[model samples]
Target: MYYLSSDLFFPSVSEANWDGVLAIGGDLSLERLQLSYKSGIFPWFEEGEPIMWWSPNPRMVLFLDELIVSKSMRNILNRNIFTVTFNQNFRDVISNCQNIERDGQNGTWITNEMIEAYCKLHELGIAKSVEVWQDKVLVGGLYGIDLGHVFCGESMFSIVSNASKVAFIALVNQLKKEDYKLLDCQVYNPHLESLGCREIDRTDFMEMLKGK
Candidate 1:
């Protein structure tokens, strides 16, 4: 494992380590976070662990124009029963996603330090969130760091059935309106694939990042 230097450039990230994990044990400073997002790498690690950076091979991303709204989902979208908003309640959104009971993670990786770091990023306009609300309650949402033209999704959760999907749909639509190019889901999973996420080589992904 390479020891991280604060002065390293994006090009130093090893292509062979397409897992996107180039270095670790760095502080979550705004500069580091900014550089990471700009290069398509973000931090992901639990408390008591060194800060782990990841850039996975076959990057999973959801193109705004390609969001797959299924027949049932289309009907849900048409109903417009849920209220969708952006950056309105970021802490609430993050807290909701941190709910281990809903996330199914035995323990939460969103430690206090991580929360404060991202919250600081949000304050600086580098991180953003989309929230899904029903009956004035926050049931689902998603959060991530946003760089030039890409939003790297960190985590999402749903308290009510399909609520997280609703939040994702709102996020994609908003990105489309803003002319954003890509929504990075970071790692691939069945749930994301069902919603139109596809994998691309990290090399290709970083090339696309340069264009953005």
Candidate 2:
């Protein structure tokens, strides 16, 4: 794998190995993080491991127009059971995502260092968050990098059933209203697939980013 230092640079995405690991050991400085996402790369590694940058071959993305809102989800939205807000409590949203337990995971990938880095990005308006509240108490939310026409979703959490899904649907509708081009789901997973996120060649994703 390629190794990175303090230099503000990244190798071509084509240089990524079959597993999609492009480099290791880069610090998550604001400039680096900005460059990373703009270049269609992202950092993902455990707390004890050096930062790993990835550009997967088949990127998972959601076209704003293609968002799937199931009948149940639409009903939930219509009921107005939860309150959704954007960029209101980003720190809490991300903290919940970091602390929430999920199936098949021993520990969270959102380490303290990662949290601090992304929080800084949030302060700069580069990162955004969505909060879901019930009875005026935070129950679910999601966060990501906001790249104008493309939103790079990083993580989401829900305490009540379908809370996160509600937040997601609200965000999609808002993005569609604003004429966003895509929502970068990063990688494929059953949860995202069920939400109308699908895999597209990295080339195609890159082309869309270019148009951004």
Choose the strongest candidate by TM-score.
2
Q: Rate residue 3 of model 2 by lDDT.
A: 93
* Per-residue lDDT of model 1, residues 10-60, tens digit only: 445554363567777767887888888887777888878988877788899
TM-score for predicted model 2 compared with the true structure: 0.98
Best by lDDT: 2
Off by over 4 Å in 2: none
TM-score of each: 0.92, 0.98
TM-score (C-alpha) between model 1 and the true structure: 0.92
What are the clashing pairs of model 1?
Answer: 19-55, 19-56, 20-54, 20-55, 21-55
lDDT of model 2 at position 206 = 95
Model 1: residue 122 alpha-carbon error in angstroms: 0.7
Q: Please list the C-alpha lDDT of all candidates, in the order they appear.
A: 0.82, 0.93
Lowest summed lDDT across 10 adjacent residues in model 1 is found at: 9-18
Give the alpha carbon lDDT tens digit for every residue of 106-201 in model 2: 889999999999999999999999999999999999999999999999999999999999889889989998888999999999999999999999
